[model samples]
Target: MSSAEVVLDLVRSRPPTLGEGRLLCIDGPAGSGKTTLASQVASAGGDAVVVHMDDLYEGWGGLAEVGAQLGTLLLPLAVGSSGSYRRWDWRLDGWAETVTIAPSSLLVLEGVGSGVSLFAALTTVLAWVEVPPELRLERGVARDGPGVAEHWAQWTHDEQAVFVRERTRERADVVLDGRVP
Candidate 1:
């Protein structure tokens, strides 16, 4: 089977911490394919709710805050309640939108901090996707354009610190080479 199909099966087999919906996290450094992998998995698993950590982040320096917000807002979803969070508007430099997620058969949280320890107990599977730094940086610059180059550098530095401290990959239930097909 294809990689997505295999992952889909694996996610389906895991038990949900909440009512009946499995909580899956696809986490990795920026441009490491966490979002792509999460999308593939979500597409394969019908009726899945996908939450992008990018939206939850307050800004380039908001990883810790995002994790805390998720802990406060999303953790309760384990008991079957709707959850919402204000999304940061990169253009306006402030919170400009509210996003809500409903309970589902599967929920995919995708982004750098998606595998944080705060959600470990509630997560059914924390999948770490890894790509070489050079490739990841290339992808990030290409995606965000040259104007955000400095921001990407700072983000990379902050991500390394957080990853080392959180041991996100070490805590992962599955590791995916995001470069692979």
Candidate 2:
């Protein structure tokens, strides 16, 4: 069965959080279909909004800072009211556009460490998408190309740190097998 199917079924079986103020976190490594799955979920989730944490980063160097702010400030605003932000463009490393999260929305934070400890209290469900390292590397290399070999090495370190601190996997309400784990 498709991973999305499993996730959809799992989510459907649970009480729908539609029209409720809650957060559902989809945490996983890069290229693990977090965005796609979250999109599928929020589409069916009544009054839901998908929030990409990647947009919170400030030129890839402010992940922790952005994450902290999201957990502490923006998420609460998003739960009941509209939230707004001026996002940083990764490629350009500059302010791009002002993004907004609406009230009574089902916000999906699809990025590694998104559902970290900071968000635990507000998160109603936590989903972890497990993708083996070899397969993950293969997919990553394919997308970023051989030119990113060094970058990947550094990313592995960053990922490890994030997971170590966040522990999003162990706290998962469900595990999503993306054909690799």
**TM-score of each model, in listed order:** 0.94, 0.80
> Highest lDDT, which number?
1
The clash count of every prediction, one per candidate, is 0, 2
Residue 104, candidate 1: Cα error in Å is: 0.6
lDDT tens digits by residue: candidate 1, 59-81: 88897655866864566678888
- Against the hidden true structure, what lDDT does model 1 obtain? 0.82
lDDT of each: 0.82, 0.68
Q: Clashes in candidate 2: how many?
A: 2
Error of 2 at 152 (Å): 1.4
TM-score of 1: 0.94
Worst 10 residues of 1 by lDDT: 64-73
